[model samples]
Target chain A: MPFPQFLFPNSKFPSQVRNIFLFIRRYFNLLLFLFLQGFSIYLIVHNSRYHNAIFGSITNQLTGKVNEQFSRVEYYFQLKKTNDSLVKANAKLYNKLKADFELPDTTSNIFVDSLKVDSIETYRKYNYYPAKVVYNSVAAQNNYLVLSRGTAQQVRSGMGVIDPNGSVVGVVTDVSKDFAVVMSLLHKDSHIEGMLLKATRKQAHSAGMAWRPISLTFPGYRKVRKWLWETASYQVATVPAYQKV
Target chain B: MNTLVKNIVRFALFILVQVYVLDKIHLHQMVTPYIYFLFILWMPFRMKRTWQMLVAFALGFTLDSFHHNPGFHAAACVLIAYIRPFLVNLLIPQEGADTNYEEPSFKSMGGFLPYFIFTGVLTLIHHGWLFLLEAWQFGNIWYFIFKTLLSTAVSLVLIVVTELLFARKQSFRTNTA
Candidate 1:
């Protein structure tokens, strides 16, 4: 039976059942393609709510995995600076303790200087858990930093990341079994609460919104601070100065 | 049937790859690659021109949903698909291209000349239009050119490599007079 029979009335096969059936089948395939493609475009133009939900959670999980793998690589590279920041941070807390008259000075009993840490707390008991950067995306428009710590490690979302110098880095976004994603200071998406050291006030984004943070991204703000501090050393990201975990 | 199934698989795979892998390759807050349009390039040669443009748009929208610049890739893809049939006809001679003509294939499309010329031109147009849509400002005009070339080069490499290794065993489907 020759295909494409019913469409044209000028058929010569005497309209056999087999030929008519074949014609239907051929047209059906083409029709199905048209219907499906039209439906696809309809779904697109209408911005159907169904497809949107499917992607958000799927990519979130994938982004989490990708961020994890990347942070592991970056964590390895930043190990040395992480260690030095830890030691220096430790010594800083120690001097503050002695100045509070809680420790008997051995060398000179000159542990008496009015520092902000002392003002914030007579004994500032801040604990940092040292976790590697499991995923670090310095290039994403909405970059995130994932750590090797999670809820199991007592790390919660919104916990501020501090550098060795006790500066702010980012906040915990997602928490897994033993992994957490940090929305880094460099993340164009994140604008966490931060303050200037010298003025001790928050330097808002050029838009002048402190709480409702916009993209006043501090790409080189920390470096500028490091230079201002008379330290031509290096700059750090989300985990601020010497506060290591 | 096997080739049809293979093409289906390739289409799905290409979309997944563009969304999962390529869109993540942003640099300096720019550099969006328009490689997803390669799906349009691999369509059956004799497919209707209008359908080709329509499918190109679907492919583009799928990727755009996963990207920052929504509708940018979709619009560019439509332009490419619109120009594709004319471009393909221009590059390949219509006479000897017989039944079961493999689309843009090295064997059926008369070796690499027509295939590369057609695909390369369409891809550049797609990428160029896409970049312009995303970045219309003149402040970073130099960067835009670099981005367009970079994206076009990457997409072209992907297209050529895909055609060489993964192109389906298309039969002579072109209905010639």
Candidate 2:
């Protein structure tokens, strides 16, 4: 059986050079294939939950930057669609703000007749802080979202983040001066207090929430604050400038 | 000039479509169609395997960066790129192999069947390896297989449709020169 000549069709070069070329030609595919496969396996093996979170954030930042640029370009094409959605969102926001200030039409009729007054104090529990999502990853075992608003914008680590349609997104986990990390509900370790609307019962996406008391009674709460201020002075000091003033 | 511009546009389009669009489409909460690998699939046949693998790695890494899944895509893509030449040798007819086939499309490959089979098999391999790495520690064997198959099917359909819709018709006889 004749050896294949395609590996070294031209033999004009020196013997050593030709031999090296022949050797590379013979084992190039296997060598490179194994090396890449091994590298990939290494990546897979090292991708623990911790690494996943860290890597996820890094990629999220990079992709977010690219997506932002792409979105800017795409924004021009979908101006009409975007305008419609913005109008709808604005309408919804208007309705919500209106409901907070104005009395019902039925209440006006009652006011015209006899003096019928009610003292129900209807107040908003949560203030919506609109933040741009700089990075969001949904395809990992543990998902996270990075938002532009952080401690500088009065965004705390415990704030509940929501989607445009008012679906629960996640709670803020970590916050820097200018950015915050949200542990999305899609994460493996994410366990939130969710009640099914129709069933009116708690549902666990993961394990049930275990309440670990960082502060229990009033006295303990004071102690916790004192400890936090002492230990986390650097973080506390970086509070929004307005708050300090 | 045309080829360079076309590939450049395709690279951007695939990355955008995959990361922004297809990656988000969790069909029935299982399928994530990766049409970006079509970039690698549609590469010139005469391109070296080494270069192909390198391009494949870049493609996978870029995607991994976006999807937040580390090396899974890269590994699977490299494996497919490695096997691509062998698969081509096995599938490409003797006469067709002698004749230069620039792109792997239905018209260029002489018919739809070979192209479909090639794309489908490779897509299955790529998805299977990727999902395996992703679900490495999971207990459900059936679910892994299900996800791989469903994803492969979806990717295959999307790739074929994209090729049919976008690929230019090439006459192999005229291009023989």
> What DockQ results do all the predictions give, each relative to the true complex?
0.13, 0.33
Q: List, residue by residue over B37-58, the lDDT tens digit for candidate 1.
A: 7778777776766567667766
Worst 10 residues of 1 chain A by lDDT: A206-215
True contacts kept of 1: 0.03
What are the TM values for chain B, all candidates?
0.83, 0.90
Q: List the residue pairs that clash in candidate 2.
A: none
lDDT of 1 by residue, A1-245 (tens): 14544665555446576676666666754454455445434444343112233443344344455556655665677789888888998897887675567555543422233454454334333467777664455443334555667677887666777556655556665555566666655543354433333343465322111211112254665554444233212322223322334
True interface contacts reproduced, per candidate: 0.03, 0.53
Best by lDDT: 2
